[model samples]
Target chain A: MLLLSRHLDQAPNYRADVQHFLFGREFRAEDLPFSEKLIRAHVKNGFISLRPGIMPLNENIFDLLGIRKKWLCARCGNRDQEAFAFCSCARCGKKCVYCRHCLNMGIVRSCTQLVTWQGPEPGFDRAFLDGRPLCKWDGVLSNEQQAAATAMKRTLAARESFLMWAVTGSGKTEIMYPAIEGQLRQGHHVALATPRTDVVRELLPRLRAAFPDVPISGLYGGSEEENLRAPLVISTAHQLIRYAGRFDCVFIDEVDAFPFHFDPMLEYAVHKAAKPGTPFAYLSATPPSELKNRFLSGSLKGVKLARRYHGHPLPIPRFRWIGSWQKLVQRGKLPSVLHEWLKNKMEAQQQVFVFVPSVSTAAALTELLQRNGFSRSAGVHSEDPLRHQKVADFRSGKLRLLVTTTILERGVTIANVQVGVVGADDPIFDEAALVQISGRVGRSAAYPNGDVVFFHNGKTLSMVRAVRHMVQMNQEGDR
Target chain B: MERCLFCGEMRGDPLSFHNLFSPEYAPGFCLSCREQLVPIDPRHCCRLCGRDLSRLDRNRVTEGTCSDCVKWANSGRNGLYVNNHALYHYNPFLKEMINQFKFRGDVRLADGFAAELTRAYRRIVHNCVREQSGILKRKPSFLLVPVPLSSERLLERGFNQADVLARQIGAPIVQALVRVRDEAKQSKKNRAERMRLRATPFQLNEKAAVSLSGHKILLIDDIYTTGATMRLAAEALAPARPDSIRSLTLIHG
Candidate 1:
């Protein structure tokens, strides 16, 4: 193998091996396992290209005036001067600046070199393109879903970005099946990227089951699978930082979710992960105003599905005044109104989702509920180490109630589950979050109706806007 | 426009006359991040290890000395080594900060503690001057000797955290020791195992040992947990016949 790598001009398979790893991914020189000689041979052969990992910030008129110096991270496109720091580098033996924003991925210093392949694309396994359907899922989509799916397929084939403005529980994942199958049959690489790890975990099994014959790899923070050559990849947006121009078609699920909506780095990752002019499909219940304005102006092709797959109206949140719930919980007492509502749900043998404004409130309320004979309840926050186990136990009906923060407001579905938002007046539950929290109920067709109550000390505009938003969606669904 | 090195928030230091007239102010941390670092008060700390005696149980602290220091003193391992002066108490926040600096390769975080390390080093020098009154007419300078790591470990971690921290003290650093054995991390060992005197993992560099013949050596490390590592390091420097040995650590667990 060493001899073959050394004589790269004579060894055809050796060049293919380099291309296989570097095809669409941008990797640091140290991250690649190959020796420098072989990589240099590839570079000499015009099969590989290298660029500095960090570059000077684009020169403006002020920069020409010699005002200040700035740098940009080529990997994550971070131009924030605050996110860069200089240190005495051990590798370069000089003062090196690195981007701290994407430091968790890998340290990209000014002296580091990023390598990418400029060679011909490797051929994918086209055995599945023998006129047989790729999707094996037997479930049928609703008429609205079918229409939106068709529009997505058409727009994506035309190489145009499309947005699926669908409500929660609108079978958004199922709508992408046809488009994904179309992409896969043509031997094109497709990816489903989401903001949160929970959403990726939730979508992985469903996507795998739908396309059993295709090789699927799921990427997350600590995921064990590292196979990047798979044609269909499901990963969190953070994992896409290492990829460049990889996917021919990318579907961003939950485009307006936390960290993704507020962080521009994830957006840059998605853009870098896809080939230029590659079509993007954005699926969201509540897109940020930028995308909404673009869609409303008809500049972007899209479809809106107001109705859910179950054809049931979304459970509009009903506001109930509960005086100072935080003080009550702190005083080791559940609010009377919320207590009565939970008791009624418990007596009816229904599981409950008690959403709190913060982790401390969730912990206190979980303990208070357990003390009040709700012994099977548990609290889960983003920092909880046993969060996965607790969520699994709740899903399996081993736990009667789950008290959670906004971490579980989306991408979680439990049948016949009723929601009670403690301190809904808190600023943490914005209009988008409240809609997502209420959308958690009435998800399954078996139990198409569940109660959603906002137990608040005082009604805020967000609460009113959330209710109004759901009511308008319901009106549109009726039409 | 300066941002906190830890939390990335604006430092927001008011433009007072002192700050305006002072030499270029180094960006350190935000007020909230800085408040999390619980500094060990010199008056209320164990005299030997500089640990906060107020936080320890009364039974464990007797006459301004912690029980661990008492045990060390009785063990007769203090050849020419003195005590350790730690800057802060080992809280979870500092533990995380150290983890980032020492393990995650965020070497820039060392700049955040430059002022504190310099202040602690100055206090040590001042105390040394007061102890040896007229024999040392001027402030005696100590050579900074950061605890060395094995070559394998240094390659793995990219940089020695102690060396980075020692550089911030603005003192002449002497590489007088090299780690001969790649032992397991001191953090993974229990207190009893660490306290048990065993073969030292350090060896004196013959080239640098000649310069350390009579100078005061101050060993720098991220944390002084059991003081066993410090004692073992000092024992390694015994062959050099240094006049005295002391340590300055960022935390006392």
Candidate 2:
């Protein structure tokens, strides 16, 4: 009887530890540190809930229609039938379905139980919310930036979604500082998510410097720092799939970038990561049509800043016809027109960015340039193991001409770098992508104007639209 | 509407009478992903090890067998074990696929290789029937015995990769062997060290020994590197009096 009383007394301590680890996260039951008996007791006491990792989509439908059955992954919100496969499970000793989409995170099989905390919310240390200024950024925001930042703060404080429809190089990251600071001042967790890893890498250092005393965690594919309880999380959207109802305010930068716009699973991840009724701040140069339409109809509150932080108009691209460049590249010769343009840039001692449509093109072009006396040129792509080192070399002027694919089109800022697009008419370079590629030039105030040339084999509608988009934005900046 | 299991692109299979009339199978991979896999050509492979002979050096090949098989034959370790038949070359692409399947614990990737494994198993059965003409007039029925991992290793990897591959053959499996010693991974050992290692890590399962009498055993595994593992496993099964032992693997590195 005495031992039973002591065990009962220790129950609250175990429950508190479980609550602390699982308060705002969804984890596989096997991943939890506690024993099965403890977890079961907590589940029975209404302090935690258990759910199947993968569930059948249509349990009530009969098999007479000859339709294939589908399953859903509760963790990643994956409903694609192809992403699920059946195997004889080792743990359950039965045929079980597992989600292949998020397999890298962990194998989520049908028998796998997902655990989440359901009891009263755990208390957090609110000592940081002493009402001092959190953002230490001393740089002044331009008039347009100031106006948009103020509007963002107001809408978020009212618990409403806000979009910053700003152009590239328009101080988008700086404008987010005030809003993020407001959330952190209230001891609320904030997450700044982007679709691309390059953007996350670029924002981590800037955000860390702006708020030096705050603990921040930057998450990407192979990032080693995994402080889940950090108040500020800067992560790629893919990493947010592991979190659940953790953030009070979520900021999505580059809202229409790749994978996020192409794959609905990432959108589901961001939605699942934030608490219910959490406000979202979207910052984008070229917003997708759905968000654009909502903002235009006045159903969603947003502000459009056409002007860049430097108060200069966007660089308009010039088109040049280069016939059959692929054949010339295969023949180990550079296009005559492109050769002359590169020669001019090199003679003026300016760095250049030559963007190709595919990885193979980047390699072949880099070799062709090197054989023709441009020894300082190099190529980089997403799969290159030395991608970070190569980009660093380019920034430090170790490589004068950087040959790259679309992976370098965003989140890179180099002063006075001239941009060249090889095969710009390819379908890969859509209007939004072309605009972002052109935005790479003239990013710094010291070199506020640079050349952007689109060398194409034939004119494409996307090219025309991209040019028009820039022209319209420049006109808006003038007004 | 079918998509590649690896790349997520449309399979885009060309329309043909063979595809339209035949019962459809689940899509494995798209054309590009399929093209990356290099199958071993039977005409140009080492007769014993089933390794692609074209990539081997001229001096390494004596008649039809590679140097490694000659070394194995000279060791006198092939008690009742026959030669191994490998389906594919261990190129970087297959290595990456296997890494994802084995180390990363993505067991679903085994589905992509189901058709290839089934076809290879049928070819092995046909060869066995042809070789043992008088001893086995009819096609021989074989039992699959996947190479076993130590208990600790099994718990760490969640599932045995050989067991997953063996299930694709649709053959009856018998757990007749258990690993007695947990050695370091075979991939980490040098060729000389692997060949010099004398002690066998496997032992016959006493409970399943009765079922193995007079049965033709085909040991299944993901890769056949030095052939030492197969010989050790065959030696372990000698106590059960199996009729014969041969091996099948996905790749011969």
Candidate 3:
């Protein structure tokens, strides 16, 4: 048998009868590199031997790098990968073989994870749209939804790009019907995306009625719309992560919301999901500071609908003092003044929304309201599995006076809702949240105006600012 | 002088490190080699059942993939090439030769494995080497991976069984991933759940992760049973940007 000490460019035929064999050791201060010792072991095995007169069989450092036992390329005997290209193996379907260019593209073959896509989905209906929704058109166009519809129709017909920075209840959904129809007529795809599920459930029925002919896919977790091979995709931002450059046009509804704003991965996912040079239009009422800076810097496009189509002035919520909500709830009591106000609203056949600071507050107040003759009130929080159903119950008028935390503060709509905050001074009820909570009232066109009463122990700057902000948004709308 | 043990296959060349480690010289042999020389070859036994090829049912599922994988080839939708590298079938002399080297610590038995592997060739090895060379004739990127040992087992054994062969093969070995899960030894678990849990745990850290991206991974192990370990590791690596993957084993357990 032959033994080859791994001295590259050494004279060949270096064979000797073995007296003793010794492997490299950690015992001494300087052990040879791990790769060199492995090459020596290979030299130790007859698996390879020095061909006489040749400088061993190969001369590549990576081959002798001791990383893999068979470091030699099965194709060529090149030492470094930069010298080769890569392509898929024709014989073997899953394997990638290197030619020359492959070495440079970082061709690492990973074990493939095989997932079976269940195939294309079926249910989609888009027929005659009801009154082609035109929202936030001209301030006096009370019936000018047709104009809003016209503008949207023109945008989709030409694939014209635009943003919709309309405030809450400015009828963002109503404005989309014509755009969706345009996509159906033009044979293109359009997607409306919002991060909130409450909004999805609220919009599904409306979309079903509007686009009764074209197929529409409502995408979110637990949705089996795998085969959304349709013209419309309404999806949450997180679901966009799996796709790579698929959608033609992406409309980001509530693009300024939490995970989309806070997570870079979600942003990367969205970027990857869209086609090259495709238009991404965002609809946000209250955008983040970054968005405002970008918009001001002329880095992004901006559009706005400043007035509520209902034309009624945005309600000003007045703040009054109440000591401690926990104390108020202990005796199954309702604040005398607040109770009288709710009683008057109920007598007038209007709905009241009692917005509490926490789920605990909602539960305590729901019981207290029931005990004090407001027996129709029910507490709603995310912890309830039937939360969606309960909200539906409220919308259907099966329940009245819904007491809730921030869960129903956005994404849900109810007509003639008079919103009241139990502890408006608490910082948990920040300016943005306060505005959304207040916006809950007077959403639908049926009742254009509703009262907003905010009760607190002390007047907070947030409360003052939220009311000012609501009035300013309304004024901006009226502009 | 240890009778200049196991060096018979070297064209009777004078002893050297090559001959010392070569199965030809310090050829690893079973204790029975003193009586009869056993043979070794590329494994023909089912990687799943480890059943002898003569006993293959042709209808058996072979657990995870051995059956379906072969059938799915070229269909385009979902398929993989080749069944597995672990189909150890050799003559009596080769088996005796390998068992002695492995069990008796006749570390030089690598030559016997190499020789028997070369023998089972029937011209296939040279043709494969030629064809592979035609494509990857350049600096061949081999992600030579030592079969991972559970941290506990690796610490206890002080060496990986797979590394022993990789050393003899003269290839680069990546110790990039570790099996965090202490999967019950393969002999015990047969279900896919065990495979999923075990497969995902073989995760890559930063360096292994970097090197793994777009690499040609050669999953080196000592045995293949149910191919659970190999398949799991391959699946885990599939997302890491490896260009392709194949496994090489010293013997089928």
lDDT per residue as tens, model 2, A13-94 = 3367788789888899988999989999888878888899998786554733447777889999999887787777667778
What C-alpha lDDT, on a 0 to 100 scale, does residue A284 get in candidate 2? 88
When sorted by DockQ, best at the front, the candidate numbers are 2, 1, 3
Tell me, by TM-score, which candidate is best: 2
Which segments of model 3 are wrong by more than 4 Å? A1-161, A184-186, A296-299, A330-333, B1-253
- Which residue pairs clash within candidate 1? none
List the candidate 1 regions with Cα displacement exceeding 4 Å.
Answer: A1-18, A35-41, B1-4, B9-26, B30-80, B89-92, B134-137, B148-158, B174-214, B225-242
Evaluated on chain B only, candidate 2 has a TM-score of 0.94
Which tens-of-lDDT digit does each residue in A1-479 have in candidate 1? 88878897565433778898998999988789899999998888788999999998856877656666788999998988878877777666778888888776667888889999888898777666678788999999988899999999989988999999998899999999999998887688998999999999999999889988888989998898577568999999999988898899999999999999678899999999999999999999998788889999999899988999989999888889999878887889878898899889999999999999998888889999999988889999999999999999999999999999999999998889999999999999999999999999999999999899999888999999999999999999999
* Model 2 stretches astray by more than 4 angstroms: A1-11, A15-20, A33-47, A58-68, A119-127, B13-15, B23-26, B57-63, B66-68, B133-136, B149-159, B178-208
Mind giving the per-residue lDDT tens digits that candidate 3 earns over B1-253? 1322343222334557875785634343333343353223335454433335554465654443346344333233221213346435344554555544443333334543554433332233342456563455545456677767677765433345566666665556787667778766665665565434332558764467778777667777766654566666766666677766667665554
Output the worst ten-in-a-row residue range by lDDT, candidate 2 chain A: A58-67
Q: What TM-score would every model get versus the actual structure?
A: 0.89, 0.91, 0.48
Error of 2 at A212 (Å): 1.3
DockQ of each: 0.40, 0.49, 0.01
Every model's TM-score on chain B: 0.96, 0.94, 0.61
Model 3 local distance difference test score: 0.57
Instruction: Give the count of colliding residue pairs in each prediction.
Output: 0, 0, 82
| Real A-B contacts recovered, model 1 | 0.21
lDDT of 2: 0.89
